[model samples]
Target chain A: NAGVTQTPKFQVLKTGQSMTLQCAQDMNHNSMYWYRQDPGMGLRLIYYSASEGTTDKGEVPNGYNVSRSTTEDFPLRLLSAAPSQTSVYFCASSERLTVYGYTFGSGTRLTVV
Target chain B: DQQVKQNSPSLSVQEGRISILNCDYTNSMFDYFLWYKKYPAEGPTFLISISSIKDKNEDGRFTVFLNKSAKHLSLHIVPSQPGDSAVYFCAASDTMNYGGSQGNLIFGKGTKLSVKP
Candidate 1:
């Protein structure tokens, strides 16, 4: 089974352009997350959803937005892409919110020029 | 400040040798710790983990040792193989904080492990 899936494996955007990164899970997990991995910053959380219809900002959510209307989908939106926003984004899901590590998707490599 | 830190940026080891990746956390309140491995162009996957109550946990060739008092944890891969090469990340979460609904992980700068055959 595909535990977690992220669409748009690769993309290049210009500054001020907007886009969305899609994430879905077949495991029917309640908690989903969006994280970005940079060269030396590791994986920083951008947004998270504890359940369907709930979402919250994480450590690095300045230029991003997220919504969770259904249990299977949580999409991250970039209002205006910037050079600093260029990074590899990963989506993840977990069985529970209080414990357990996440199952991550392949990743979306984005470059903002 | 980064609560979690992986001092070494990268490590290299020969096949069949032991590979040790170290992680340290500044937040003493963190209870659950985890390790994740990521290949190039892929997302990081869960590797192994340890709780603050336990000092060690093992699964097959991988073992996670936690030193709560020292705020340090390490992942040891015995008889490392070429397939084991990847970027290893150290992550931690504090379940006791803010009702634990925010079970988000704080990750350290990963250490890329290269296993040569």
Candidate 2:
């Protein structure tokens, strides 16, 4: 079973370009999160949704936005990609609010030139 | 500022030896701490965790120790094997707020561990 799937595993975009990072999970989890991993910076939250139709900005949400229309799909959009946005993006989900931990996707490696 | 810090950027341990990775946090409200392991090109996976109420928690060969007063935590892997080589990340959350939901984990930069055979 595919726990979580992210599309465009690798991508290189010119500065000022726009792109969407797709995340889907088969676990039917209630919560979904978007995070970007940079050098010397762990996974910093970009955006998150506790449930469908409810999204919240995270620590670093300036250049990104997220929409969770369905429980299984949560997509992240970069309106104007910049070189500073180059980083590996990860998508994660948890079954509940417990400490069981989150199931993560393989991740999308994005590079803004 | 980094709320959670993994001071060691990397560590090397001989096979069959103990691998101890350390983490420190500045947030006093953080009560739940966890360790995650990640291989190249993959996402981090949960390894072990300890709550503020518990000083230590063990699962098989992996153990997590929490020192609340010191705001420190460590993950110990006994009899380290070659397969244990990877980047380890420390994450903590304040469960009191929103019941630990809303994606409240604050993570450290991570420490890459190498188990040499």
Give DockQ per model, in order.
Answer: 0.67, 0.63
lDDT of 2 by residue, A1-113 (tens): 76999998999999999999999999989988999999999989888888889888888999898898999999999999999999999999998644456999999999999
Question: Model 1's CAPRI class?
Answer: medium
Q: lDDT for every model?
A: 0.91, 0.91
iRMS values in order, in angstroms? Answer: 2.4, 2.2
Q: Estimate each model's TM-score.
A: 0.96, 0.97
Question: Compared with the true structure, what per-residue lDDT tens digits does model 2 show for residues B48-91?
Answer: 88889999999999999999999999999998999999999999
Tens digit per residue, CA lDDT, model 1, A1-113 = 66999999999999999999999999989999899999999999888888889888888889999999999999999999999999999999997664475899999999999
Residue ranges of candidate 2 with Cα displaced over 4 Å: A97-99, B99-103
- Superposed by TM-score, candidate 2 places the C-alpha of residue A91 at a distance from the truth, in angstroms, of 0.2
